[model samples]
Target: MPTVSDFVIRRIREWGVSRVFGFPGDGIGEFDGALGKAQRDEDGLDYVRPTHEEICALMATAHAKFTGEVGVCIATSSPGGFHMLNGLYDAKMDNQPVVAIVGQQGLNALGTSNQQASHLERTFSDVAVYVQTVLSPEQAQAVVDTAFRTARIKLGPAVIILPHDVQGMEFSPLTPENWVSRSSAVAPSTAICPPEDDIKRAASIINAGKKVTFLVGHGANGATDEVLEAAKKAGAGIITALRGKQVVPADVPFHSQQLGLLGSLPSYNQMKDCDTLVMLGTNYPYGQFLPKSGQARAIQVDLKPEQMGLRYPTELNLWGDVKTTLDALIPHLEAKTDLAWQDKVANEMVEWENEMEAQATLTFDDGVNPRRVFFELNKRLPATAIVTADAGTTADWYGHHIRLQRGMLGDLSGRLATMLAAMPYATSAKFAHSERPVICTIGDGAFQMLGMNELITVKKYMKQWQNPQLIIVVLHNNDLEQVSWEMRTEDANPVWSTSQDVESIDYAGWAELLGFTGIRVRTDDEVPAAWDRAFATQGVTLIDAYTSRNVPPLPPHITLEFAENTGEALLKHDPHTVEVIKDTAKAVVTEGVERVKGKLHIGDDDKRES
Candidate 1:
């Protein structure tokens, strides 16, 4: 009879999981044996070793995000499993399909408080959609199947806890049908279209409003064309949540930028101006950005019925996939010939672009500004590049400035809101799509937190990468800029411990020591050349640029609270408080003026030309 480990590994491979990310340990010797034989025979799953189990979990999460396949990661007993929690939460929060297999202490050691023992099931309960421990060899197959199936179907993490003793136990005979299956563990799931009456009701609601805006999300991933069709018919402008940024091209005539605090003025303007908000495939949680209840009629479409109207009160809640709903609802919509609303919003976007360009050009004499650095990177980035951003001011800059082309794939921690994921996410993207350039943007503080160590993992696997252009852009501000900005701008508190005064490490030097082409830039003149050098280099490269920490991440719209907080924080903290606030306030006021002019028909192009 085959060992339980043999059956577990075999079933994982059978479930269409070609690779597993994790580290080997003494407690998982039986599983390691099975993995070793599988690798030797080239008939089992490929095991990828990362420097840390958290990195392994992050890599698995990213793999699932990119491929829509069930990503798997393995860990040893106790501490190893504990390390996976952060990454597992990243997957769970992002709603990516991932399965974590953790080795538990021997079953005989139960209640003995053995070394490396913890309640694995209890530990994973909150993060996993399915969590169970295999008590015996006979239970291995069912546990593995349920974990994979649940992960894929639920689009979240599942955990399987295997004790050391159970792993070594004799199992039932391994038949082909018992271990291997042709279908994907999650396949045979059908697309759910909304009922005809509900679709018609949604169409009716959308048609009734003269000015409408369509908010798209990640659920609209593959239905871009249909979304555009619906938008055209309904005569609506399009705005996307951060995850749905790629659903519609930013350069399109009616497509506005993202919404919320990190969003653009045009998106906010469109949302406020629209009479009806037709939300598709997204339960974007920022209700403040959305029209309040009774402020606008709403039509929400989601594959999961429970998500419908959870964020906003919907007049018509259509339960369906994005593409199917759009296809069914299109014929019912009245094509609006008077596209004045969309055209006006489009003109505002052009003005916003002009403002962005002007802001990107402003910089201090000490170092290159973060905006210009990102602007230059955006210019040089390949159209087919895969971009990942760490959670910080770096992501805020990227969100505002970087406009991804149709072929590009860009992502940040949308809901996880965590740091140290960018490097692993970019690495996974590079590994999955080796022909595309992979770029990870991170702040200096976040880079020091976890990204610096993960560079070694990139170096180790650099030879296997076909693209040869794995680039890491470090915004070296030497502080936790986002946190500090929030404390000052949101809470009106003087920045105290939020700011870091650590001696700056030569990030590029570290990259060079790790067998990567490293370049550090401080001037505007050196910016483009550094990016060019990184892109042209034959292996992994790091471009570290010292950016200004004082440059405020100005919101598209400055409310009274934001303005007051900025003034209060500056007066209380910095010596040059007035000058700092005045300088930043100039840009904010100018953008605000343009929005007013657009609303009042003062400076619009058509009005001016007339």
Candidate 2:
């Protein structure tokens, strides 16, 4: 008879799970054994072991994000489960469907202070939509089914705990009885649309306004055509949340790139100036960047009703799938002839792009400008490339400089947890789409935290990819750049060198040791060629670009509070204060010059060629 562990593996495969990310331990030894047996039996499931449980979990989340499949991760009891929390939270907060199969102490050992035992259900309660422990072999299938179902429906992580002994038990199917519930692997359709009345009401609100702005998030992904059509008809400018970057390409005329701190100036201005706000598939968290309450009438469309009005005071809420809802609502919208607002927003976007180039090319004495690295990569990025970024100044440069063309995909930890999911995300993305090239941008602090370990995971699996063009770009700034800026701007305090400074590491040297091509970049001129060599290399490559720590990751719109707080911190005579001030002044001056040139049409003939 097949063991319960065997049945669990077979069932997930039947549910279309071809890959599982995990780290093995004695607690899951039986399952690991079963995995080996399945592999011998030519089972299609590919089990991948990362260096740590946290990385495995992050890989699972990335798999779901990249492939649009339910990502599954497995880990042992206690410490293994604890390590999976951060990645699980990343999935939960970002609303990705992930199922975590964790080991637990045997039923007999429960509450007995057994070694490696933990109350996993209680621990996972906050991050998972469903948490269940299978007590018997007959219960395993149903639990697995329910876990996957809940994860898919809720769009979050789900947990299934299997006691050590349960894995060894003889598999038994649930009987047709009232107490023993049986479930199928088939997922229900999610094509939903709002009622006709609600659609008309939303249309009326949008039709009433002179200046309309559409704020889109990750949920609007597949509805790009509908969104663009609706925006064109309504003469509205589109602004994306970072997660929604791929939904509408930045090259689109009326699409303002991104919103909030990592967003663009045109997006910030559009939100503040619009008379009407239409939110689609995104619950963008930064309310301050949005129109003030009562300043603009809002209409929100979300698959989840609960997420609709939480961020903004909306006059109308449409509970439906983004594509379907927009498809239904588009016909009801009246076409706008006067596109002055749209034209204005588009022109601002052109100016913003010019300013971005100026910022990227700004000279820094300490190291190469980080923005220049991303700006160069942006020019070289293939349309099919999948990009991942870690949380830090790396994300800032990525957000401002990297423009996703059609067919390209990109994402990070949307909640910005700073656990450094970029490496794992890129790893899983390459696994999901073996034929596509992948790129990851990370800061030194995050790279030191967990990215280095994940590189080994990449080294182990590089040959498995059809296209082994994985580029890991490390922003080798010898400082915890983002946090230092936050301390200065948010806390009005000087840099705490002891806590913020990061020890330098030869990331490229480390990659070379792992049998991967490594390029060390220290100057602006070397940045473009480094990208070129990485892209040209047929195997995995790492670009260790030394960037200036003093170069500020300026926001789209600098407010009074931010300016004042930064001024206060500088007044305290922080270490590197002179460098910070000089870098900042240069950036601001560049922006001003770019703006003047844009307005006067002075530099159009002399624009830098790509």
Q: Backbone clashes per model, in order?
A: 0, 0
**Across residues 477-535, which tens digit of lDDT does each residue of candidate 2 receive?**
89999999999999999999999999999999999999999999999999989999999
Error of 1 at 570 (Å): 2.0
lDDT of each: 0.81, 0.89
Score every model by TM-score: 0.93, 0.97
1-610 in candidate 1: lDDT tens per residue?
6789888888887788888898877667778888898789888886778789998899999998777788899999888999999999998877788999898889988668989987888889999999999887666777788888888767789999988888889987535565443333344463678788888888888888888999998878778899989898888999988888777876687787788888887888787778999998887988988986787899888766777888888888887778888888899999989999888778878877777777777766545778888888888878898889989788888888888778788887778878888988888888788889998999888788778988987877777877778899999867777887787788987666435443589999999898788898988788889988888887788998998776778877666677678678877865435545655765555555555554633324233322
Instruction: Quote the positional error of residue 566 for candidate 1 in Å.
Output: 1.8
Superposed on all Cα atoms, model 1 deviates from the true structure by an RMSD in Å of: 3.9
Give the runs in model 1 whose Cα sits over 4 Å from its true position: 173-186, 497-499, 574-586, 589-610
Instruction: Give per-residue lDDT, candidate 2, residue 275.
Output: 98
